[model samples]
Target chain A: MKRNKAVIAGIGQTEFSKNSGRSELQLSCEAIKLALDDAGLAPSDVDGFSTFTIDNNEDVDIIRSMGIETLRFSSRTPHGGGGSMATIAHGMAAVESGLCNTFVCLRAMNERSEARFGIAHMAPNSNNKGSGSGFLEWSMPFGAATPAAWTGIQAQRYMARYGLTNADFAPISVLQRKNAATNPLAWYYQKPITIEDHQSSRWIVEPVFRLLDCCQESDGGVALVITTEERARDLRQKPALIAHATQSIPFDTETVTNFYHKDLTVFDSGVQCAKEL
Target chain B: MTTNVKATIPANVPATMPRPQPLPGRDSAFFWDGAARGELMGQRCAACKLFRHPPRPMCPNCQSVEREEVRLSGRGTIHAFIHPVHPMIPMFDYPLTCVLVDLEEGIRIFSNLYECEKEDVRIGMPVEVFFVPTAGDKQVPVFRPARDAKAGSKGARS
Candidate 1:
């Protein structure tokens, strides 16, 4: 069957912050409404939804609250930020497959004030247990509790094998900050950092990084409305066409720490995704 | 009511209170113990004698359960490093330094290198362990440039 061809019709985001007064459900609804408005559509037009498992809101509750006409599809991806692009990938697939015409992809969290995902070792539960917990269990007892600590392992190894340094990572932060500065919706919007600033920042993990080199813990919501390309062209605003999308799991991949793998320096999953893109 | 009677309290306190748990299993116990002592430890197979971190009970190469705990020399070179611009979770405004160390024990350990100017942290610089304490009375072994080492050595490869 020919693919239906999907495109992003609208985008909406709440201000990023350490805390938001509203509940997670309220954040989800607000972003979804904004995206609908941007798309020149209504809650009644959305038939599908996709988000992450880490999100606290449920699909049924969201649909009921929004009064969506008919819920045709809904899904939750895993792996936190790694699933950012993957959520879009799934939405595009759902649209192209003719399973749903209007789909929404969203990430809503009060990472700082509510449930911080970056804490030193989260409790093991049904969703986070097994493979997820297994990977963490290996390091947490040894004091590698935080995500930075886990990534520090790979980051340090990468630095050792290559001729890279803390300065090299500064560029990455600078570029992202520059991009965020221009993006009014970004939490760090209007705030720019220099290499000197990055260097001067306090150390979070030694040799692997500094304070400015990390991402923020903001309480906000970001949403994208996806629909068929043919329909998107007829919409009020120009759509960012979905050129391609793919998700990947590298060989012998574990959640975050794949120490047992032959090569720990590179993120093979990301590399694979890049290749597909 | 004044009789000398022992009061029966609910025995649920032990169940409710959180207990100290080991991060690793029997196979990798040594790595955790070593970290508590501020030492970088890895597993070596009795057969092939290759070193591995996040220590496993069995050797990946030889599948030998007869493994030994080896103390790493803590001297290694940086393979790669990055300084994140955005604040990642639990690390607010914290700069990160990730390095791959080629241990003198013939094994490579990945850790954060610290205690110097972030600008001075070049790839291939010699580094040694600097243990940081944790909440559970355990210590984490981080790395930084060793004192009195040659300024710029070739970057270490995996």
Candidate 2:
């Protein structure tokens, strides 16, 4: 199979925190500017932008703020967290299609300090009427309102089938905290949670999850720059060559997915994506 | 092991916090409507005879546009559950034992055990469908201990 080549030229991110004390737009601009600087590219050199579809900041607003005059390519991916890694695929495609030379993928949000995604939103369909995809409505009314609750539904079934326990999942968080403790950029930097801490943590919903089971919602943003492999070699820094990326597959496992397979615990889409990648 | 003769929702639950209602859309209206009458309903792909939940328009197995409402046994076993300890959302009954039950009909539903404490619920615990009238003209299909749930009570470690 023939493929076009692209490379990640630079990466930039704001400090992780419960509060960034900055508007999302400002955070976005700051991250993007840092990425541009890291890539040794001027604002004028960036011609395209790609990000998650739910982003509040408009491309017009971003490019204008960056002083990039003529934007040629821009795109956004659906499904919020899935969009994080998915945009790199979009950027690669845009560059391969000759739509733009330099593509910037960015995301900025004040998840903890400003708005939150964990709130028990009214209905999955929402009273906002005709607002969302309505997938959430099925569980929302029953109190599986937050993202943790949403995923916990699946996690619950997985544990029950295998007879797994909290002790099984505690090591995952403990190891993550252990790693984060040494990383100065981490929210839990210099502070690690113990197995005891995980065991004693309060529940957000029961047997399979605890407060430590969840990642603390942090404020801030991150940005990345993508360009052609040929063009990337000429940039200021060593290019992180894009090995491969997967297409946007439907992330929803319950509805619109194949159930013929034996175990619902294993994600078929992920298996297929991994095999392909 | 400690066992409660009967499970119960905490007494102080706030009715003022309107329970989140099912947003029944065109694809799932039938399932929601059926639940209102105490029936656990799922969508059966007319072409494949496979059953599914949180109803959708077509069959993922056969790509068939045709589907039919399949009444379910409403009898299932606890597949997995979490005892949410924190009141991140004050609306939730603290220490809520949220569960995912794998129905005998080959689908999973997110619900809670109405009559048991967090300790009483267990993996593979048998439960039967029971309706909790949450909002006007809408009822949420919840689960409670089935008659045989006690047989599996030992499955619970705590």
Candidate 3:
């Protein structure tokens, strides 16, 4: 893991939307093509692929559709959004280890228009064998069905221990919306919220989370090109050097419905990951 | 809605959705069975003596396959609790409090907290487990504010 061994040459994404009116595979190909174009590389230049395990798009479909030449390496990391950064790490390792000359990392989703994870009735199917699936068995029977339901309890404990109220969280949402408002690509572009707005928002979980506190479900795709720093220097875009990339999964953690941990306030995995970094 | 109903649905809305069931595998059935029998069951490694929950086939510590079903003391303190209000489930009463409790046996359990006022629900508040009928006609462990516990005395356990 030598410093500056690998770098991100280009990044691209589809416009954020509630409905992309296209399949995830199409969105993935489009984003990847955009990334390749940005890097001044053709589809044939990509030799490796890295993405999330939960991503609906398949490597074979992408390779066939993009006409990529000589696919040599492919890997998918688990943990969905939590493992998102790991995709880049995988790509970096592929290129740095001399396994491949160029690698592409991607994530494409139809989160809103297709399947909604935030909906109460949309519990992860036990038969599907996916992340956070069986973990819901202990929870769903008790009416804790949604992600909000699973996360709300942990938020409550953290707030209570710190002597903080729900109002204390309003500023965070306000800041988030404020930042989004300034970004043209943001869903809430030009629409900043106030603390009063956050307070007035309907409660998703009483005394813990409001509607504003929750993340918006949207459909989109994003991809990145990773190659050796030496090769990246000649790319169209200025290369962003990768100093280090690592992922860690601590003991006693089960994805979002991680209720078994002794301490509800602390995310041991993040702490362990930071220590590794 | 009647005064005695645990959850409140909108007056005009029909409560049509069925609640999700555990569909427990062989390894985790003991826990659901213990709840049906008015007990909280946990798993302990027969070799290393370390306890695990949501039952697994093997112990991570010693890789021991031999394990025993241990009945845990239904006593614990509230580590965290939340009341869900949106995308309401018809089976559940509105303003329901779901709590994460740290058991006396050194494991945490996720169950709903009942018979407690919103203002009274706080972190480290002592609570005791009880069985409640939930979706799928399953008897699951829930919690209530412990009787005989002093109020305002935080039951913080590190």
Question: lDDT: which candidate is best?
Answer: 3
Looking only at chain B, model 2 earns a TM-score of 0.82
Fnat values, one per model, are 0.20, 0.66, 0.85
Scanning candidate 2 chain B in windows of ten residues, the lowest lDDT window is B1-10
Candidate 3 lDDT tens digits, B41-155: 9999999999887789999889999999999878889877787777877766555678888887777888878777766787788888877654566677888877756655676
By TM-score, rank the candidates, best first: 3, 2, 1
Q: What's the i-RMS of each model? A: 6.6, 3.3, 2.1
> Which scores greater on TM-score, model 1 or model 2?
2
DockQ of each: 0.14, 0.44, 0.63
Residue B88, model 1: lDDT of 37
> Model 2: what TM-score?
0.85
True contacts kept of 1: 0.20
lDDT of 2 by residue, B1-158 (tens): 11111235653343335455566778889988987888988899999998876677878789898998978888887776665444444444444566777788877777767677667676778888877665465677878878765554534212
Docking class of 3: medium
Residue A83 alpha-carbon offset, candidate 3, angstroms:
1.4
Tell me how far the alpha carbon of residue A213 in candidate 3 is from the true structure, in angstroms, after superposition.
1.3
